[model samples]
Target: MSMNPITFTPIGVIHSPHKSKEGTPIQPSRLQRSSGEVEIFSEFRPGLRDLEGFSKIFLIFHLHAMQESQLEVTPYLDDQTRGVFATRAPSRPNPIGLSLVDLFSIDNGILKVGGLDILDGTPLLDIKPFIPDIDHAEGIKVGWLEDKTHHFRNHQADDRF
Candidate 1:
């Protein structure tokens, strides 16, 4: 096998109230219901044509604030050190992040979204409609997070990573 560097041009920018990772939510929270805007670049505005119909969307963006990567990390919700792949730590080999947000409206190239957990000025990679029939699952296990998720609502970004 061979490895090659891959490059991507950001499609847009994510504008949110989260200016720093220190206080940003680790993930999108339906309870918090924070609202923000996704500004798609002019060249990508055509892709937003049918996006308004989606009630929710998945925002794929670069974790630009990450300082480094760790193979093992103490996840925000737990004290045990675990493999990075087992947790959603921002400092990863690729530093990519995903958020499922409620889509309220789209005007021109700006998208109004709720439940945003991403930091402001984050580079948007892609956006996909969240089709419940396709994205929802059953009989799933969350590993270490199974017991830690109850504290999700109270968890916020810290300087651990």
Candidate 2:
């Protein structure tokens, strides 16, 4: 087997109220009222055309603040340690984060979004329009998260990761 290193250039920066890992909302669904900005670089501004038609967008970003990677971690909603992939833990081999946020408006190269759970200064990797017809599904299983979803609404991030 062989592996190759992969690199990606950030398309923009995510500006959010969360300056620190502690107390930040763990997921976008948990922070619906929060607002933030995604400032796309000038080179990528042309890609923003027709994006306004969507009510929501998916933001894929790098977890820039992650200090280390862990194979297992105690997630915010659970007391038991779980595999990194089973939980939405920041400290992972790739450290990528994704969130679906409300697209409030787009002015110039800046996109005003709501329900932002990402941290400030996080590097934006990509943005995709959220299409409910394609993105949403019915009768899905959440695995370990199924029992924990009920308590997630009030959960905020701590500095564990």
lDDT of 2 by residue, 30-138 (tens): 3447798999999999999999999889999999999899999998888899999998888999999989889989999999998888899999999999988899999
Best by lDDT: 1
For candidate 1, lDDT tens digit of each residue in 76-140? 98888999999989889999998889999999899999988899999999999999899999999
**Model 1 segments more than 4 A misplaced:** none
- The residue pairs found clashing in candidate 1 are none
Scanning candidate 1 in windows of ten residues, the lowest lDDT window is 147-156
How many steric clashes does model 1 contain?
0
What is the lDDT of every predicted structure here?
0.90, 0.90
Residue 60 CA displacement from its true place in model 2, Å: 0.2
